[model samples]
Target chain A: MANKIFLVIQREYLARVKKRSFLLATLITPLIFPTILGLFLWVGMSDTVGENRKVIEVVDENNSFFLESNELYSFSYSELGQEDAKLLVQEGLRFGFLYIPKLDIQNPKGIVFYSEETPPISMITNLEASLQSKMESLRLQASGIDPLLLSAFKTNVDIQSIIVSEAGGERISNSVVNYAIGFLAGILIYTFIFVYGNQVMQGVIEEKSSRIIEILVSSLKPFQLMMGKIIGIGAVGLTQFLIWILLIGLVSSLVMGYFGMKMPQQQMLEMSAQQGLFPADGNPEIVEILQMIQGLDFVQITLTFLIYFVGGYLLYGAFFAAIGAAVDSPSDAQQFMFPVTIPLLVAYMGLFIFVLDDPNSNVSFWLSIIPFTSPVAMMGRVSFGVPWHHLALSISLLVAGFLSTAWLAGKIYRIGILVHGSKVNYKVLWKWLKQN
Target chain B: MEILSIRSLNKSYGSHVALKDFDLSVSKGKIFGLLGPNGAGKTTLIRIVNQIIDKDSGEIYINGQALKMDHVRNIGYLPEERGLYKGMKVKEQLLYFAQIKGLRKQDAKQKITNWLEKLNLSQWKDKKIQDLSKGMAQKVQFIATVIHRPDLLILDEPFSGFDPVNAEIIKNEILELRNQGVTIVLSTHRMESVELLCDEIAMINRSKKILDGTIQTIKEEAKTNVFRVKMIPDSMEYVPMGEELRRQDGMLEFKLELKDQKPNELLGMLMSKGEILGFEEIVPSIEEIFIQKINESHGE
Candidate 1:
């Protein structure tokens, strides 16, 4: 049986890897192709649009405004008349003409911008903010009050969160960091499960449509075939992911090297700071953020992620295979998708609503403990920090859930692969399950 | 020796019985034709033997041993809805099937090459099955079925999609395999092929074995001992105790039942009444027997 499964796995792996779409998707999917395309686009755009900064000619009636200039746009205050500024813009000497006719401060009106194209909203909004503040200060001055006192009332407040571990060590922790890790790990599991799970589905459909299921089963059990396919496609998914990481890393670094752009060397900077070569103490928040990141238990997080990643895929992939077997085509598989997706949707929503915000909440506890939702919901809680019992309970339940689902799915798959129908529903699926 | 045997195998889906109290024994080296009307549970029986599905309550033995997973390698089944992976090269697909059935890669490749060449498909081995004609693809499927050289081969409608020339080639190959001491169970509705190739046949109808025996025995069982005699009678008025079928210019054709009479005695009695032109026994074809048996079982 093992040998037969290995043969099946070998065939499935080779068949998919040989397709042109696999290579194309691997190269284009993970930011590598787009990044290279962006590199060329950046180079091309720099020659035309980057070199010429947009210059706006301001014709202020009061001549009291001092407009600031930036790299993408420049402000030119001209004593020239409105008509002359419009003429300058029409003559292509300026990108736009901003005419601010004497504003009645209380009711500012008749401010217009004339350009060949519509001015960006950012440019208009920036101008409005600057002019509004200026008018407010002018109003304050007319009232015989110092605007500096209002500015003195404004101060910056930074709230640094500190967490006291059970071991009695208090450290400044960043929720942003925790959220990032949890979100990344959770979404990765979600994406990998769907992508690879669909691969297993499509593979089953292919075999069924081609009428190879019966012949295959004659040589080995249907369960073995389904498993071989799942494992084989999962291996391919892992292979593609690793290749994307390697290729994207290699190509992006090469491009960055060519342009003499250095990545944020946080580790190098921290090393220098520790060696007293560079004083990162200037930014206390940065030091604390770095330390908090290092303080995270990546070993535990990574281990759980791996366990659930495979576990989640197996759990959902079995259902996907059964669905594929039950339907005649990919389009026909839609009716069966809703039920399978419910648990995933609940887990996804639950991850944000409960797991991330309050991992220890009862709702979060239930979501993590349930096998269907735990693969994703548990990841968020794990990243925050979970009691060992919760982890053990969830993992154990997930295994039981997977075994039962696999058994159920195998029964359906054996019959469904041979069943040809125009319509299949939950009733038919139930009948098939009872057939066992 | 019986290489394949099924005793009182019973299988059903819900209230619908597929196979019930089915019994069959195929000798070591012969093609046993499984004849049945559409939806008569022939495929179900074959599936049970292949263990693709389980029998509700019965026993199936391959080579005098209870059927088990290890017996998979001993059986090569060509399902009615047979197919090769369309996007897969013929050689690659064959190798996969062969290796999965427990053949080493080198030996499988060798056998695949020989089968492909023998089937006039050597030039098409590198092409994907979709690229080949239907007949060419069928040839490839046939090779895959027998590449492992299984002891018992169960083929369901193996000739359904093949053209005459290819079907003949396949028939010859099946015969060749039988000559090599392989037991084959062939399920098809084509009665002429059954008559031409089958050594023994089992007729399944309405989830039951209605008739079964050697091709000759079944045909003989359904025989009427009737003969088609063509003669030039001495006198048209002296008609015998036989139905006149036709009169073709001095030839009197009629059907005569030679029940319990020796061929010589019947010939002697007929010779005196007419100068016998032709005297031939009327035997029922398997097709006729099949239709008759099915209609009898259906009570129509």
Candidate 2:
């Protein structure tokens, strides 16, 4: 039986790996991320359309406000009436106009932006920030303080999060890095389960539809065949993922080197500093980001990811296989698929709502402990630092969940693989499950 | 020696019984015919022997040993609804099956080459199964079933998709395998082939075996004590005391009631009046016996 299972796995793996479609998908999927990123960067860097700068006319009734202009837009202060500014905007003389009415210093109101198209949020935010700063300086002057001196005294505070371990010394923690790691790992497991679990189900449906399953079951038990398929396809997914990581890393680095571009880690550090997470004195050090990444317990998180990936796939893959066996065609599988997909969908939603928002929250804790949601939700929390005991409990429950689902699926698979030419429903499946 | 034996095996699916107290045995080197109409328990019995489905109750023995997973290694099954991996190359598919049946890789490769050559399929070795014609694919399915040289071969409707020439080839191979001491359980609706190949037969209907015995014995049991005689024209003055059923091609076919009289007594009376050109008792064909038995059971 063991040898037979090995043969089955070998056949499944080899058959898929040798297909042109598999090769194309595996090779192209990883490149998709870098490709989209490159496209966005190219579009941003290249300004082919030589259009006039967006002009905005500012009408300050009190004549106490001034706004600056950037490359994409030009602001012109005017003594023109509000009605005249609106008419100019209507005639396409300006992109829009900002009207500032005389306001109480403490409670300013009636500041409105009018545009032919809805202005971008960033534009509105920039305008609002400029106005608020000007108003603050004016208020400082009214209190008989030097506005320049007040600006000179302003200093940005940067908080460094550090974790002191019993054996290892203090290590800096970056919430941004932790969130990115958790989000990526959680999504990776979710994608793997969806992709390879479908492969297992499709393989079963193909064998059943082709009528090869009867011959297969003759020599090997149904459970062995099902497990062989699940494990085999899982290995294929792992192989694809590993290859994608290696090839994407190689190709992106080569391309970036050719373009004289900094690595993604350096770029992410710059982005973090630009987001005001670091002091604005100079460029943020790359070593700090690297240290924060190293401070994360990646070994633990990666190991847990692997465990949950396999456990989740086996649990869901069993249900997928059973659904595949129970239905006669791909079209017939949809009705059964909804219920099976519900748990996965819930886990995904819960990961975003509870785990990513606050990993230590009660909702996140419960979702991580539950076997169905834990594969995604737990990984989402792992990078945020989960309790050791909770992780162990989740892993144990997931294993038990996989085993029970496998047994149940084996029952349905044993009977359903042989059944044909009938509309199998939940009632029929229930009867099949009830049988020995 | 019985290579495969089943005793009082029973199986049911929900309220529908597929096999009930079914007993069968295929002796070594004999072709055992599992005859039945469509929807009879013949497939169910074969599936049990192949261990494809578990029997609800009963015992299955292979070579006098209780059946186990290892027993599957000795049995080859060609199912009624047969197919190969359509997208897989013929050689690779056959090798995969051979390996699954427990052959080592090198052994499977060698055997696959041999089977491909023997079946005149070497030219199509690299072709996907879907590329082959129906008859060619059926031949490949047969090779996959037998590539491991199993001791017991169970073929359900083995010739369903084959043309006559291909069917004949497979029929000859089955006989050759039987001659080499392989026990065969053949379940098919083609009774003519059963008459040609089967040594013993069992007919199943409605999940039960209604008739079973050696082919000759079953035929004998179904006989009506009828005889056909051909005599020289106009040589007899008085006819034998029997109902003259028909006269065709210079043969007088008659039905006899030998309640107390011996067959030789009637033969003596016929010989005195005419030259006995041909004389032989008539026995029913398997097809006739099958229908008659089924009708009798249905009547009861």
Candidate 3:
């Protein structure tokens, strides 16, 4: 019996793996994110392709202030009227023209930027900052206060978040990193179950609709067939997922290397260090980030993920298989699919709302413990640190849930696989379930 | 030796009784026809034997041993609604089924090649089932069914989707397999094929077996003892020692009461009246017997 199931699994796996669609999907899926990211970065960087400098015509009616020019924008002070400067911009000669009317330094008004197109906010802010600083230093001089002393007193403060463990070890915790990891893991589980679980369903439906189930069931039991197909397709999903992870990591690094762009982690570390958030002795933030990652209990989370991934898939996969057997065609499956997918949808929503927002909340706890939702929801909670007892209880319940669902679905599948040309409903399925 | 035996088998779906007290015994190397009208529980009986479904109450024995899951390895079933994986190549599909039936990988590969060649489907081995013509696919399904060299083969309406030429080829293959000591249980509504092949038969109607026996024995038991006799052109209108049923083409047909007199004595009496041109006893076909038995049971 076990050998037969293995043969079925082998057939299922080999058939899917050999398909062009599977190969295309598996190969392209990992490249999609990186390729899109690279495309966007290319587009963003190419925006600097035009004239290397911006020529801003400054018309200061006060005639007492002089503006400086930088590499990005060159200031052209002119006694010419504002109307003439606007014409130069309209004729595409100047990038933009700034008109600063004479005003009280205490309360400036009617300070307008006149141009054919709206100037970028950064250019406008630079102009405003330059003028404001000059005005401030003049005011300090008039009040007999030293401008250099006041400038020396200015300081930028940085707040650091450090997690002090019970073991007297300090680790920096980045909320953005935690949120990203949890979110991605949760979504991955959700997508895996949805995508691969449907593959299991479609496989069963294909076998059933094509009448191959008749030959299949004659040699092997229906439960064995169901389990074999579920496991087979689940393995396919896992293979694709692992490949995607490895390929995405490899491809992104290669692309970044080609462009001489630093890794995002290194960039973040360098930026924080330049801001004096970390001491120059050693990059403690990088070390702390790594420690915090290690302290997240990935071994437990990953092991639970695999267990729940299979468990949730089996639990839902049995019903999907049963649904496949019960219907005559793919369209007929729609009516039965709603109820089967409800728990998965709920788990997905709960992951975003309850688990992500507050992983230790009662809603998250209940959702994670329930077998149908646990596969996704528990992964969400695991990244945020799940209690050992909750993880144990959830895994145990998921196993039990799979067995019972398998039993129930086996009954329906046994009868449904043989029957054709009738509109089977819940009543008929109930009757089948009760039969020997 | 009996290859398969079932006693007092019963099965039901919900409140609908599909089979009641069904008993059958198929001897080795013989074609056993399971005859029934639509919804007459033929599929139910076949499924029970194949272990595709469970029996509520019964005992089934294969080679004098109680039926077990492992026995499926020794039995091949081609269901009425038969098909192969449409997206799978013929060779791979056949090999998969062979392995599922407990053949080793090398053995399955060998058997697949042999069956493909034997069925004249070697060229189509690498082609997907969807690409094959309906008749060609049917041939592939037949090969898949028998590739494992099962001891007992059960086919339900195996010829439903085949053309006459393909049907003849399959019929010949079935006979060839039977010649190799394979016990075959054929369930179909095509009585002509039944007549051409079946050594013994059991007719089912409304969830019960109404009649069963060798084809000849059932015909003999249901005979009216009628005979057709043709006389010379110039002959007396002499009557035999029986009731005259009809006269056609210079032939005289009559029904005799064998209870009172022997067939030899009746022939002697007829010989004295006219030159015996033709004399033959008429036997009922299985089709007629089936309809009669079913009508009888329905009436009861």
Give lDDT per model, in order. 0.87, 0.87, 0.84
User: What is the lDDT, from 0 to 100, of the residue B170 in candidate 3?
Assistant: 95
TM-score, one value per model: 0.86, 0.92, 0.84
Per-candidate TM-score, first chain only? 0.79, 0.90, 0.74
* Ranking, TM-score, top scorer first: 2, 1, 3
Each model's Cα RMSD: 4.1, 3.6, 5.0
Q: What is the per-residue lDDT of model 2 for residues A1-436, given as tens digits with 9 covering 90 to 100?
A: 6877887888999999999999999889988887877777666556433355689999998789988777777899989999999999999999999999998888999999988889989899989999999999999999999998998999998878887766677778777877887788888888888888888888999999999999999989999999899889988988998899898888787667655797756665776677646445534655567668767787897799889988888889999999999988888999998867898999999998889888889999999999999999998888777778899999999999999999999999999999988999999999998888
TM-score of chain B of each: 0.96, 0.93, 0.94
List candidate 2 segments past 4 Å from native. A47-53, A87-93, A104-107, A136-155, A166-169, A264-288, B230-240, B246-254, B272-278
> Lowest lDDT 10-mer window, candidate 1 chain A?
A261-270
Ranking by DockQ: 2, 3, 1
Q: List the residue pairs that clash in candidate 2.
A: none
Give the TM-score (vs. native) of candidate 1.
0.86
For candidate 2 chain A, which ten residues in a row score worst on lDDT?
A: A44-53
